[model samples]
Target: MDLGGNRRGVDMGPYAVRASGLYGMLKDLGHSVTDGGNIPVPVPEEIGVGA
Candidate 1:
């Protein structure tokens, strides 16, 4: 898969979610929920792009 350029944004999506306070918003909607926190995933450095 050739990821030409502009691939950095995809890697930061998860961090953006935490920054946006999604967990808190959902909890405020009067629904029981538990945020298990971020899942384990490898960064681009750890797993090099194979394009």
Candidate 2:
């Protein structure tokens, strides 16, 4: 996972994954695929540390 981004909505990594066609490409190469969807992100407050 990323360190997250500077701005809100910068965490849109799942969209990037689909746009990059990672799942489809992997499946075409004979991989067993399933879209497991996204992981939950922590709220900034919960981090309790930052740069």
Candidate 3:
């Protein structure tokens, strides 16, 4: 969510990992993968400071 941070794009991490074939790689190693999906989080702009 990048709360209390100056940088951006931290929220894109999950998408990046999925695009890198993490699911397939783990499955190949005998692990069961389940896509729990993304949780809903409000952006900093939506909630405002100290919200």
What TM-score would every model get versus the actual structure? 0.44, 0.46, 0.59
Best by TM-score: 3
Ten contiguous residues with the weakest lDDT in model 1:
1-10
TM-score, model 2 to reference: 0.46
Candidate 2: tens digits of C-alpha lDDT, residues 2-39: 55556666567778888999989999999998887777
Model 3, 1-51: lDDT tens per residue?
556757798877778879999999999999999877888877657896777
C-alpha positional error of residue 12 in candidate 3 after TM-score superposition, expressed in Å: 1.1
Q: Which scores higher on lDDT, 2 or 3? A: 3
Q: List candidate 3 segments past 4 Å from native.
A: 4-7, 43-51
What overall lDDT goes with each candidate model? 0.67, 0.77, 0.82
Task: Estimate the Cα RMSD of every predicted model relative to the unseen true structure.
Answer: 5.9, 5.2, 3.5
Task: Give each model's clash number.
Answer: 0, 0, 0
